[model samples]
Target: MSETITSDEGTLIQESRVWQAKGWTARVIKNEEDDGWAVAMYKDGEAEAALIGPWTMGRDKKNPKPLDHNAFNTLVKTASEFVRRHEQQLHASLNKSLMLNADDTDYKICLQIIPDEDDPHAYLSAFNNNGEQIAKIKVRPDFKLNPSSAAKWLEQGFQRLD
Candidate 1:
């Protein structure tokens, strides 16, 4: 029978091979590719696992290391960083921005990608100095948003095209 214990953030199940804490869950399972073990980390309420990698065996070499306080804390830190970096990368890919130094007006131009299975889209928007959106236009999915590119687009009356 698996033992369940209440942790500060979540629960720990020895038999089921799960350590849930700090809005994340670290689960150890048998590696399908070989006769080894792997650990999967999932964010709270997320269906997909965020990270999965090999797990170290205990001293006996036949079982995974127990999820003790130290191990659990370390796992939480590693898993948290992994999730953080993944989020940063996702944000960078989906959204981009650049500053405009036009002679009469300054603006911040942004391009945000809206991903959809059937119809992917993007938006090119410009915000004035007061953080007010002055112009927003729906653009193609693969619009390049960078300093030089944004400047050129703005120079051409905010019309972006290849």
Candidate 2:
């Protein structure tokens, strides 16, 4: 049985092979692909582990190293950074922005994607230097959001995109 401890820091489980604290859980498991060990790091409330990597073998060379405060902290830091970078990449891919000068007025054009499984789409929007929205229209999710497309849209006076 696994022992659970609650304290000022947070809920913690410091078993030999399992450690949970700081909104993360680290589990040591046998690597199916080889006769070695692996560690899985899961963020709290998430069903799937965020990271899985090779684990160091114990002195006996047949078992995994026991989880400890230092090892668990390092795993939490690595997993948290992994999840953060993934989120940033996803956000960058789904949302984009550019600046252009039209009629001597600076304009900011942005594209935000809505990935609905049934009806995928995106919103193309423009704002003036004053931060006031100038135009917005729904466009296909696959709509290209690049300098050429943005210039074309600006040349057309931000008309509804087909």
Candidate 3:
């Protein structure tokens, strides 16, 4: 059996095929897609891995290279960056803003999507040049906010939306 080390924090396993430290885990597993090895990086408390990639073969060319401090640090950096980019992209998709002019006054219009699994919806809001919210109303999640639509909505006095 492999040695198991523990501290006040959590389990810290440094073995030939698995490593866990610093709130992340890297495991070497047989690649199901080919006759090679793959490494998976998992964030602590997460059921699924955050990143997976090919692993280099060891001297024997039959086993994976043992996880080391340097390799694990690199894996953690790469995985963290990947997760950050994914979150930024998701945020961009969920929230959007645009500017339009109505009645000779400049206004900023924003549409934020609420991705509730049970009752997904969105809110369309208009703010004046002073950044004061002028109007806000519940809109469909798929509401398209373009110059034409926003201008029409403003023309209609931000009334009940369809």
TM-scores, all candidates, are 0.79, 0.93, 0.91
Residue 58 error for model 3, in Å? Answer: 0.5
For model 1, how does the per-residue alpha-carbon lDDT over 1-162 read when each residue is reduced to its tens digit? Answer: 357778785565644477665677778888999878998878888998877889888788988876655665787788789878988999899999888899888899999999988999999999989999877888888887888878887788876455
Candidate number achieving the greatest lDDT relative to the actual structure:
2
lDDT of 2 by residue, 1-162 (tens): 367899776778889899998888899999999999999999988999999999999999998889888999999999999999999999999999999987899989999999999999999999999999999999999898888899899999899966
Worst 10-residue lDDT window for candidate 3 reads 1-10
Predictions ranked by lDDT, top down?
2, 3, 1
Shift of residue 129 alpha carbon in model 1, Å: 2.3
- Could you tell me the TM-score of candidate 1? 0.79
lDDT (Cα atoms) of all candidates against the true structure = 0.81, 0.92, 0.90
lDDT computed for candidate 3 = 0.90
**Segments of candidate 3 deviating more than 4 angstroms:** 1-8
Worst 10-residue lDDT window, candidate 1: 9-18
lDDT, candidate 3, 49-132, per-residue tens: 999999999999887888887998999999999999999999999999999986689999999999999999999999999999
- Which candidate do you rate higher for lDDT, 1 or 2? 2
lDDT of 2 at 124: 97
